[model samples]
Target: MATAVQKITLSSSRDIPFNKLVLSQSNVRRVKAGLSIEELAEDIARRTLLQSLNVRPVLDADGAETGMFEIPAGGRRYRALQLLVKQKRLAKTAPVPCVVRDPATDILAEDDSLAENVQRASLHPLDQFRAFEALREKGKSEEDIAAAFFTSVNVVKQRLRLASVSPALLDVYADDGMSLEQLMAFTVTADQGRQEQLWQAISDSWQKEPYQIRRMLTEKTVRASDRRAVFVGLDAYEAAGGGVLRDLFQSDDGGWLEDVALLDRLVAENLKTEAETIAAEGWKWIEVAIDFPYGHTRGLCELDGMAADLSAEEQGTIEALKAEYARLEADYDGADELPDEVDRRLGEIETALAAFDDRPVIYQPADIARAGVFVGIDAEGTLLVDRGYIRPEDEVPVAEPEQNSDGEPATVAVDGAQPSAAVVQRAVITIGGQVAEPEDEDDDAVKPLPDRLLTELTAERTLALRDKLAITPSVAFQAVLHKFCLDVFSRYSSYGTAMEISVRSASFPVQAQGLKDTPAAKAIDARHKTWEERLPKDRTDLWDWLTALTGDEQAALFAHCASFGVNALYEKGDRYGGGATPHTVEQRIADADRIASAVDLDMVEAGWRPTVESYLGRVPKRRILEAVREGAGKRAAQLIDHLKKGDMAKEAERLLAETGWLPEPLRMAGVDQTATVDATEPEGDREALPEFLAGDDEESPADDADEPHMIAAE
Candidate 1:
């Protein structure tokens, strides 16, 4: 009789009897040696096994309680339980849930137990390779294996690569604990023969000198042809060998080595011989050319000396050639001169002079002698008389006119009339006066006028008297005198009684004058005074009043005061202080507050309540609570109302459909239930329901195909 089937729960650990758990020998061996076994056990002991174990119960022939179960996967859990038991951490009677299975059924074949094991555990490379082979043998595609094992196709492919590598290398990895990465470098040689050769090379290096294995593998030079041919036929292999040979030795001497010293000496000797020959030929030509009697050095040196005195002979030959070249060049240079027409004109002038009665007199040697005058012609062709005697009577006396009957001297009239002495005197006086005015002025008058007077005048006079103003003036004096005149009479005279009264009323009394005392006056004063106070006292306050006004206020005030000619105030007067218009400042602050409010509201509306809460940390809790209550009462109600009325559910369905969360049928169902139907059909028209009830007619072959007779004819 068969033994009774048992139901049992066991904690995963190495201490669990191996006979009790039905783990594969490969899986059992891997659990015993895996690096993470201890950690997995510790985690299982602490966390009560985060993942449940998948197992199937064994049944006896009699179908009685045997109190035992066979684990389909979760070998790691079994190992962890063994460890826990060894460490005295688990009870032997713990219950584990499992599916019951018939004893005759092949557990690995009936259920994907191995696939589930790989999906859950990090399998060793060797184990994965074996698993991949087993799956492939079972006619499972790589993609199916990948999906079952929760890995990429390429990852499965790489793990399956063990079969492609040399068996010798796989054995080396299994026996010597070689890293999969290091083993991967050898996998590049997929050929059974090449892989075997490479594997032997690696094995020999590892055994004789383990440290040299990495260096040897990295330095291994496989010809491109060989790399390609490893996966192809012998013809490809031979072609690859030919390519390697050609590439390796195409250059002279195979480019493998060069005799550096010999090459260097050869190049140096060729350069030296060429240089010596060039020098010898140069010297021979120089000697032959300089040996002539009529050459440049003929008079300076004899032919023997010419050849021997190299420097002098060389210099003389160069000079002689240069002179001859210059003479030849000068012949062509006349081509650029004036044409013959110009020369003919010059000749005509000479001929005409010769025909004149004067006969174009020339001062010859005899004429100079007869005249008893030594005349010398200078390089410029001007004759110079060194000395000449003059007769006493030959001198012409200076002419003088006798006074007419009117006592006025007889004078030649210019331009039809002799100007009167009085008229001339007046003109001379006017012109002379204008020219001499600045020079003739009193020294005191020439000194610059005070800036006060100059600045207070109209632009016409101000510019006229600009040079008269002081180069530099004290700010206090300029402000009080030039801009704010103290003399009431002068102010009244320039701007009339009304403006003078206004200025006088705004001004401070001489003894009591100060900024505070003239509050209204200072407020209206140019804004430059504030900048001046910030600066050293030496600087001028030119733009004070203008700076105090905002752009709009300035424009408005300019427009308003234009009729009264108040623009001249800024043109002539210096500024006194700085301040912006109240309107503009308040407007800017309000605009900033609006922008900040908008941003704060945006954050709050966007579900950034936490950020808003952080910023309102300084706000009173009661005020915050009040604000939230108000927002909930109004905005929340409105939002809910909007969501209820709007097709938000439909929109959500659409979004879900787009993201593939909702399948096509569910999405279409939602649309059919929510969307309106066509009104053209009667409300009770059951005939329209045929298409919907009959499924899609377009996809049905009976509806799509032609009649049998029509098909046969075609």
Candidate 2:
């Protein structure tokens, strides 16, 4: 059997009963209140309905059309139309357009209606919660509801949970911009009443307290075992007098109640009086002075007091006791035995000393006590104190003055004059290869001379010798100085230098038997070789080599040579060739000059001469010319131009010709060709030609081709 497809037409209100437009009371209120349906009604009246209503057709048992389709969605729109009819703006019997569908389609229609309302209308939290709950009542799960609206299940649940909050708290939250996290924390209390109570408390506290304090209070309230009671108590307390607690603690104002001013003054006066009383009785208790070494000085003081003011009989007994103690001390000087009677007396003395009460007469060292001195006491009734006195034997003594050979107080001498032994010892200087004589003529004369004079004299002598040797000239002053220093070193060789060199050269024995190869032994061997090579026979050519170095080069080479020792120069492969073979000092000097010239030119070519002069050292004229020649083609011209502007142009011209550039013409003109080009052109452009070679036309090829032209199409 085949089935026929029936075409169903959407019917207007004319084909259905108008009374069927009745909607839920909630929907009707929403429409009348200008909330849900007003905008839709205005849109429909201004512009024709852009969308048709979706409704499920309802039929009676006879299948006759008793009522029109009942709208699942568009309830608000349906209500708006009814309102328009009542206002006489729309026809009382006017037909409304709607799409009819099966009864089951009401679910989708309802969902679509909800989405439309949600998209167009801004619902309150309460309204959102109601919508979610209504959907839940239709047997929809939280996940289904969330998925239907493209939201998280948790969000849907939260909205539904908001239905449990009191309207007052919700309004407060909305007004204060309180975070949802804080509100959620407050809602931890399962009981709705308790949550409301906490919410109110938090709201009230937030208005009066600082943000931190309110946060603290909120945290405390939420975690509290009995939140409802805590919140209620807080609210009641705030209602009563607790609102002023913060002000009372922080501010000086005491409100309208007690005499805080008088109380404060009285309290201050009492504190002052109490301090005075404490100060007056500060020394009421005696503190014994004792130290670890002097275990109980207080006990000794007590013993002395016990012996003071005794009667004749007591005095005799103490004298007898002292005699016995002296005898015992003598006996125990070499022996460790003590007489029973002496021991008994000592015990009695110690006991009596411990029992003495001199609190009234006792005085404390005021400064020491104020500085907080501490004393130790033991259960044996021993008071340990520090008397704070240093014995003479424990002190370091000042040295005594020494007398002269004549056994008389001698005068100290200055400037190589004879001085007392005291002056000589104290001055601590060598004079004539012996201890210097101290001056007794004047105290100031006995004092040591300043180091500046010695430094000045030494520097003058050194500079004079340095100048004699021409150390800072072609020959490295450092090399010459090193050679001179080696001569000085030779004089001290027998004193231990030879022995030290020998010891350093000797190989270390392994396990005290055989020799071992080690760096120390190698160094020692190297030193021995150096020492041998530095001998007079080996040093014949040393001066010649030293004289070969330039002042700066000599300084650097000498410093490097000196690092290995003066003897190192004679050793094989020692930085300078062995002292046996002499390097041509003149040849080395000339070669160095040539090298320096080359380096200087390299530096100038690289634009580094100024930097080199600033760091390594200055270059001589020959080197400067060499540097100019190396960079002669372009940079030399620039240098010449720079020189021409200054007084050095004549000198520069000589240097340029020496470097092999076209100096004669440049010198005649007194201007550098490169400088002229640089000054006029600024930057050279090879692509640029003479003015005559430039085109006169300014219009571009495109502009010229803009005129119409017929062309054959291929």
lDDT of each: 0.35, 0.38
lDDT of 2 at 150: 57
- In angstroms, the error of model 2 at 665 is 81
Give per-residue CA lDDT, model 2, range 497-569, as digits (tens): 1111211221111111001122222333354356444434435776786687567655644432332221111
Residue 89 of model 2 has an lDDT of: 79
In model 1, state the lDDT of residue 136: 92
| Superposition TM-score, candidate 2 onto the true structure | 0.17
User: What lDDT tens digits, residue by residue, belong to model 1 across residues 153-237?
Assistant: 9777777776556776678778865766666655443455765665565453312232233223323333322211222223433
TM-score of every model?
Answer: 0.18, 0.17
Q: Please count the clashing residue pairs in each candidate, in the order shown.
A: 33, 22
- Evaluated at residue 166, the lDDT of candidate 2 is 58
Q: In candidate 1, how many Å is residue 245 off? A: 19
- Best by the TM-score measure: 1
Cα RMSD (angstroms) for every candidate in the order listed: 43.0, 35.0
